[model samples]
Target: MRNCWFATPGIARPMSIRCWSSRWRRMPMASDRKLTAFFLGFAARHKWRFLLSVLAMPIYAYLVAEAPNVMRRAIDDGIMAGDRAATIRHSLVYLGCMVGGALGLVAQHWFMQSGGIRTLTHMREAVMRHILGLGRAEYDKRPLGVYVSRSTSDVEAIGETMTAGLTNLIADTLLIVFIFVNMVAIDRKLGLMTLVIVPVVVVVVDIFRRILRPLYDRIRTVNGTLTSQINEVLGMHGVIRSFHLQGAFNRLFREDNDEYRDTNIKAVSYDAAVFSILEGLSFVAIGGVLLYIAVRATGTEKALQLGAVVAFIQWLQMLFPPLKQMGARFAILQSALAAVSKLETVMQIPLPVDEGTKSPENLNLTVRDLTFAYNKEQPVLKNVALEVPAGKSLAVVGPTGSGKSTLIRLIVRQFDLNPGGGEILLGGTDLREILREDLRKKIVLIPQEPSIFEETVRYNISLDRPEVTMERIESICRKIRAHDFIQHLPHGYDTVIAGEGANLSMGQRQLIAMARALATDAQILIFDEATANIDTETERLIQEALDYVMATRTTILIAHRLSTIRDADQILVLNHGEIMERGTHDALMTRPGLYRRMYELQRHAIPDQ
Candidate 1:
């Protein structure tokens, strides 16, 4: 029957719901232990708040439990005896209990919510730090949306458990226990009879829980995928529009969205079913107690009094709400646990290794027997060798996918090399032996596409670096020939850049990247086709800047435009990750080699402009 019911939506993967339930039972206990430790860490940080919340629960429960008994005393001793004073006394006691209980509830919630905010803030910071620390390879394993979802939505889910679900679970349990004890104290036989439905309610809750656990997991998983799809689509909206792929992306998004909706509907169906059964059973318990009173009260020897009956009725009313709330809170707890598991997986990605402690003393660069591949079977670069003496320049030219970028990544230590693959050295120190922080300060890569932030031009150029003052920034901009254009902006260097440099021309954006690179005053400068996207006039200005900047700096220039590298001290014509030819521009062009062919082709293509 469970299998048939779960089959209606057909969302569960790998197996039917029955199979999933059986497998879930066999899941290892270690995961539960890990999750327990996860919550324990949360408690350890905010122990006082959690303790206060727990301590207030029993106080609130006791007051709530005694309220109905107070009403019973008023009914039997005052209303039945026609004494207004007794009724007024009991009424006053009831009011006091209500006020006291409200305060306890308020205290419990306030402490829990405040603690949750602090915990959530710390948790988000940890996740962001982890994401930033991840290696370039780890980032390739998942989409940006997955990280965003985990950091934002998943963290919030766990926060909800801390604030509302866990707090309510404890409070409701205490409330139920106190209500049961008071009922039994009033009339043991009636109290025992009312509980006949408890076993059935437990069974129903268990079955629905099994049904919803996997469903909730599915819903959360689909939400992440849907979010990733949305981010990808939005981030590539221009490309999609250029390729007329709106309909294709729309269909893909619809599929993920529909799957999300279907899983949620299944979860809601089972959730509603649980609540319906709980409500029905509550009514049954009440009706059974009333019937028992009627049957037993007919005798001359009364089995129950009117006061007890009234109190019992009132207690039943109080009991079922918490009963119903337990069901809702359980759903929230389950969702939180699912989020915990997802976040745990993300946090387990290996952090980048940065144990290098040595610093280089010079800018001389050397690559020896350099070989690499994203995977073992398909090598991108093999047995590559190159060198650039301090204060000298080297130019690398190759067709796309000839491992030009791979070589650059290797030189910058973006990917760690295998033991026998290759070695890159700066001065006499191996690249792997140099501290990453120090290495970043000395080596900078300016790519064809510039990254501009939504800040003033001054911030974009200086990047808030302490060393790059306003004077230094102006000097660098002037060297890069960008000072004049920047001064013409509405606010000069203080003008705020639009997102992705929408307000700036392609040439202007590239010029800003150049100015930033120049301001660094680094020993070695790497320009990877920096002028590829700029106009001819901007390229000319950038070339002039490059001449000045490269004169004293050890530079690695990777370019497609052969004319730009004509004056490079040594030019290497790279093909298929190997140095096919190496010589000065005039020497290489004089021979019938790859460099001469490429130079001639570009020279003819440009039409002497």
Candidate 2:
């Protein structure tokens, strides 16, 4: 089979057929291709508006070009000849051209802005949808703030480029073209003399672009890093303070902040230097035009007419502002291109492949020769095999890093197993053959550290499920013995929990997590050290709740405390990724194996409850 690969910013590897498979791969750096492809695709979606914008540009250019000609006629045929009527007629024509040019400009701006906005909106929506579709494993690999930066600042830059930068760029290019055409139309020799500055300006702008591209890339990278650091610090503020590492975090943040500031300064300095050079070049071009006009007027028998000279000067003036402003416009273009590259890189991440068509009808669980490794070299679960009948509780006990949590992760498809390593079955159907959503609905894992959103208790319990009514929620809470404490809260089910349930005690958070699990009404429940973090008092409160929740469902409990698993239907002792012993409470005690030894050690380590 062909290996599947997805790319993010740093890592690159073929996606393995595991539960936590990557869908994205690194896209090659093809800035030009990415930019051109995006605009072309955007234009196809808004064809009429884009075409209309293009059409208005030449018309606007023509109207603008007509103004200088009318002025030349008024000065030569009317004013110099002492004919007021001719002057008035030419002046009226100039006014009419100016008005028409102004209207055309409005139309151009409207069409371009409209098309750009629509295109960017669609792009933003598509990026957001892709981000949402990414698996938990992707989020685990990248900082939340990096993704936020991509969605906000980076996206805004691209939008600005498409709308304002693009509009002005097109308008200026057309204006320059028409101005050059008219300058030559009036006096070919003089126009050619003036056009000599065009190449000089083009070369300068090109030099600036080459110098600034890498600087802007640096700015964007630093900004993203700074944002990521800030987000991480804020998210873990509690831990940082508890450990008294505030000073360390401050130093780290200061370094990142300073780096961001310095990069931006460098980019701005380059922009300023380019702007100053272009402005100086503009003046030089104007002076050269004047020198040419002075020589032609003084040395020739039939001197250049005053009217033609003035009109040509006006055209020359119009030409240089666009060239002068080109540096700033190019800066925007570069930033936007960088944003596009980033967006394309993210969009290439592959979504999870959900090809399973089977759904389990019962909750009987079986694991056969299940082996896994994070690095493929050192196996974590080595040929593990176990079975749990429907509605039976299985307790898994092991020392730390002995594949206890790894086994649970494999069953939940957190990471994919190697082909031929093993197979897991639910209700006699292969686990890989069951749809993810269907599998999740049937089995729920209440982790040791449950995530509680900053929302009402009701919302957290229901998890936005519209069908989970208040009565059902309260009933579940009551069964889990969480209702009394919830009722004592300020708003009962409506009470809003703080971030990660910081306002609630450890036991309260675990109880809420239990309530959530029970709310799902899943057929199988896996408790991965759910009561490990709480105090003895909290564990007592939770044990009552756990007994009721595990009574009907098939349960998988991972516990260090032997007391917690005393009533378990079966206990499997694991050590170094292999099953060391297996039996019930009495049978395991008689064996004098890993389980019996562990039980005796814990019993002696602490007094019985």
Candidate 3:
């Protein structure tokens, strides 16, 4: 029955949501749908406030619309008819209407502005939370500059413009409609004449919208580039200065700045042209109305009253600006929509890995015939098969890009392997069925680069497990040669490792990372050349500590320096993502292979082992 339900008519097959890098072509409406849903749902919740804003919009227009009517009546029955009582009574009504309209206009501005500000705050926070929700795996796929752009500029654009658009669109549209209706009611032929500029205004604005949208997108692209460049220069300030490239870098910075300026200037120039054209047409239409009124006034029997002419001019002045503002609002909407679409596209990309349903305690991992590739034609790791015997060590060795690090990642399931690529045996079961969180707790891998937050050393090592005792922390630190460094610090473990532990040496940082992994106390452990960047003395110290810490623990070691793996129970040589050779050190030396060659070359780098 369940299968039948899934197979029913009009139901789509549950295709795997492929990773962005994996797909050859882009997905359809992927980002547009997500962005539309988020924005629409948000607006829907404030529907009542929105309607209030909408209703308030035309209040100002109502005043302008009523202006001409009041003038017509004051002329026909009060002023021109030569009756003092009628003139005074009608004059008072006109004064009252002006005062009330002015006050309502002020109130209208207050509510629209308040609502825009309030909604923007909510949207900014939502974008921030969504970013924080992603795991380390998801973050690694995106560029640092792109992420920065999304948070600072992109969210701000989406939030501010969307709310501003909602407000102005409501108000401007209402004002224009009310004015058009009144103009037609008073004099249908003249009202029709007034709209001649509208089609021209709309056409000019449509061109402006199309041209300006791409510019905003380009501006954002350049913004990401500028951010990335700044980050790279700042991150590698030491290297840049050492290489004496300050002058060269400054030139590059100037070039980027100039490009950004040129792009913005061009967009502004074109938009200015659009405004100029619209403004000129508005003046022409009003001039025509004034000329026609003047000619008709000289010979007309009800020669237009003095007050009536003044109020008609005010109504004309009031009408054109809101029309102009409507165009500007449309421009903002176009630009903001472009940014939202880009941001939404990235967010819609499915996370490559998902957590397993089984409990962590009951889970283990298995890998058999495992193969994967960044590109389909050439596998980064191919037909690689291995096992982590329960409570033992398996060391992997090879040159760079030979799939050593990729092996560790695969064990953690950071990337998907082909269905028949291989099987990872966890205890007695295949890893495919194990619960992900549970599996992670059972086996944890530490990498070459040590990750530290701007936090205390104790917090870095302890992670989220608050139950770890100080004694256990001290033991791990001592074993990794990190205890001495901690003691040397001004506040010991309490000292804050700000700037991601920039104060610590590379060796000390790696030791701290090892301590973090040790704190987990998982059944299986994998170390990926953690000692590569440290000096020989520090490497030896850590190696000694690792021997003690790794005793009887199921471990996978990826070593670049052959000396570290001398005591490894089993060593596997991976070449081009395939296991080319495998055996103990003495056994592998007896055979002529990739492992033997690498061993001979590294003997100078790993003496007395």
Candidate 4:
């Protein structure tokens, strides 16, 4: 059903009522309908305010259309007849109509602005919620900057169109209609003659729009690309500075900026051309009316009155401004349509699947017949199986690209297993049957490079978990031997750390990670090379913390330093995504396997230790 709906050509995509539903579902594809149709459907959700805004337009247009007729009366009935009282009366009525029309215009602006804001706010929130629900695979496939553009720039463009562009479109259209009708009623011959220029003006405007549409789209695309590049360069500031590549990055940014500037210049040129043509056409329409009036005055049978000619001219002047503005408004509508199409493209990405129902206890970890690959061509972890009883420590040792980190990610459900690939069990319940949040609470994996936010040490350690008291945080920090360093900081536990812990040493960050792991109090802990790249003294401190953490919890350690995992209850040696050996350190050492050879080589290389 979903495929058929999206597959049908020229079909309008209906707005989903449950756009923010939590349940995982496939993202809807972009519709084939015109952009205006999609926008109208979006606005339909807030129909009452939209209708009020539309209603105000015609009311203002009616009052404006009536002003010229009142002036005709002031001239033909009062001024020419030399009746001062009648002239004043007609003049006052015209003034009242203009004042009333201005108030109606204000009301229309307010209503349209309010409606646009409400609708786009909901859209922004829904898109963000959908993004949050997506899995890690989606994030890995796209840059962070791409998502940022979708949320910020694209949304703002759509909002601007809805608030100002849409209102002007309706109001100008109605004003044109009202003026044309009044001109005909007052002077039919001149009205019909003036109507001849309408088709020519429309054709010219249409030609300009056709030229401008693709240019505007290209401009928007370039702007998004430039924004993405800027974000990427800024994020890699540390790496670029370290490698002395500042000039290279700057040159790349300049190239993108130049392209963006050129595209914008082209779009603006096209817009100005359109506006200039419309302005010239408006003056031509007025001249055509004057010529028609003069031609009628020479006719013997159907003479035009001076008052009626003046009224027709007034109506023609009023009509041309709206016509001129229509071209620009159409361009805004096109830009908004482009932005909406981009937004719909993002909305179509399916949410991550989570069908788990069972919450397990005891949390003894098991992996059976595990076979997986990030890509189909090569398997990363093949036919792997393992069992870890509660409170037992299992250490996995492997060379680079041996699927050590992949195994850890699978346990945490960062990526789902392939269909029929394998099954993971926690407390004898299938891992697929446990909610992800519940599974995470029972098992925590601390990566080698921990992420530190720009927040206080206390918040960093506990993550502001409600059940984790300040005393508990301090106790855990003390246990990990991080309390002393934290205390020595300017504000102790209250000290605000810089982003990624830039203000602290690598050892301090590792200590904080250890404290965070202990704070979770989960049944199982997996450390992926947690002590890598640290000094020997820091390694000793982390090892001590690891020993204390492993005493009562089931732990999985991926270590490059053999000494750190020598005391594990069981050790697994993996090579090329397959487990080649599994046994205790002493048992593995007695055998001529990969583990013993690697251990011997490491010990000989570092004999001083």
- TM-scores for all predictions: 0.86, 0.84, 0.78, 0.85
The candidate, 1 or 2, that scores higher on TM-score is 1
Candidate 2 residue-pair clash tally? 11
lDDT of 4 at 260: 67
lDDT of 2 by residue, 416-479 (tens): 6788888999988888899988988888888989989999999999998888889999888888
* Candidate 3 lDDT, 110-220, residue by residue in tens: 565566556556665665666766655677777876777776776666554545555556656776787778777766666787777677667766676567656756765
lDDT of 4 by residue, 401-462 (tens): 99999998888888888888898889888888898789878888888888898999999988
Q: Give the Å shift of residue 379 in candidate 1.
A: 3.0
RMSD in angstroms, all models? 6.1, 8.7, 10.4, 7.8
Error of 1 at 562 (Å): 1.5
Q: Candidate 4 regions off by >4 Å?
A: 1-45, 206-277, 301-303, 600-609
lDDT score of model 2? 0.79
Candidate 3 — which residues are off by over 4 angstroms? 1-38, 59-144, 147-152, 187-189, 197-236, 252-288, 352-355, 359-376, 379-383, 469-472, 586-597, 605-609
Q: What is the C-alpha lDDT of each candidate?
A: 0.80, 0.79, 0.69, 0.79
Comparing 2 and 3 on lDDT, the stronger one? 2
Q: lDDT for model 3, on a 0 to 1 scale? A: 0.69
Q: What is the lDDT of residue 67 in candidate 4?
A: 90
TM-score, candidate number 3 = 0.78
